[model samples]
Target: MRKIIIGVMGPGERAREDHVRNAFELGRLIAQEGWVTLTGGRNAGVMEAASLGAKEAGGLTLGILPTRDRNLISVAVDIPIITDMGSARNNINALTSDLIIACGLGTGTASEVALALKANTPVILLTENEEGKRFFKALKPKLVFIAKEPSEAIQMAKEILSP
Candidate 1:
């Protein structure tokens, strides 16, 4: 069977500690389930925290970077794909993953969620922001899911990934 690539999307520099911690535990759970973790290759906020969590659990990580400089890749990223596509890289993040886990809301995270929905990729939202809730309500139920905790999110992802 092919490897499952689980994408994690969330706020970067603007992420809150609670959201970051959620992403961290989510990543750890994903790793423990023997799935690969994917994130935006940035050193701040949820991106950094999730990568660290996955790495600490001995899981593989893939970073889809928006820059050309390899040295700028997140320290926790095991494989870095430099797109230099700026925010357009969000489309790549949505398309490449089998499913996406959104930890928090931000302009970037919102965009990634929309892109994933457009691409028919399933998305699990961990945070219950107004914008996310509104978007979730508007979308089809099969494509969007909301989880109150990391374990719940992991279980949802596993259910969606399973045949």
Candidate 2:
């Protein structure tokens, strides 16, 4: 059987502690389910946390980097694909995954969610705020799943992705 790839999308450089923690928990849960984890490959923010969590859980991690500069890649990434596509790398990240979990809201993360929707991949937004609630309601109905916590997001992904 082919392994499922769960994409973890969020802020790249700086993020709140809660966001980072949620991403970590989400990644850990994804790994425990025997799924692979994919991220933007940066060494900061939610990307780093998720990748590290997956690595620590003995799960494989794929880092689709936005630059050809290998120095910026995360050490937790078991596989690295350097694209040099800048924000356009979000498209690759979205298309390559079977599902996506958005840990935080940002321009880049929103773009990734849009790209994932365009690619017909399931997306679960892991945030509980007015912005998140409004964004979820604004999107196409039944297209994006919203979860209040990391475990709920993972559960929703599993149910949505299940054949």
In the order shown, the candidates' Cα RMSDs to the true structure are 1.1, 1.2
In order, candidate lDDTs are 0.89, 0.87
Residue 23 lDDT in candidate 1 = 82
Can you write out model 2's per-residue Cα lDDT over 34-57, one digit (the tens) per residue?
999999998989999999999888
| Runs in model 1 lying further than 4 Å from the true structure | none
Worst 10 residues of 1 by lDDT: 131-140
lDDT of 2: 0.87
> Which predicted model would earn the best lDDT?
1
Those runs of model 2 whose alpha carbons end farther than 4 Å from true positions after fitting are: none
lDDT of 2 at 154: 81
Please count the clashing residue pairs in each candidate, in the order shown. 0, 0
Candidate 1: tens digits of C-alpha lDDT, residues 1-163:
7789999999888899999999889779889999999999888789988999999999999999998987777899999898998999999999999999998878899899989999999998888697776767478577998889999989998899889
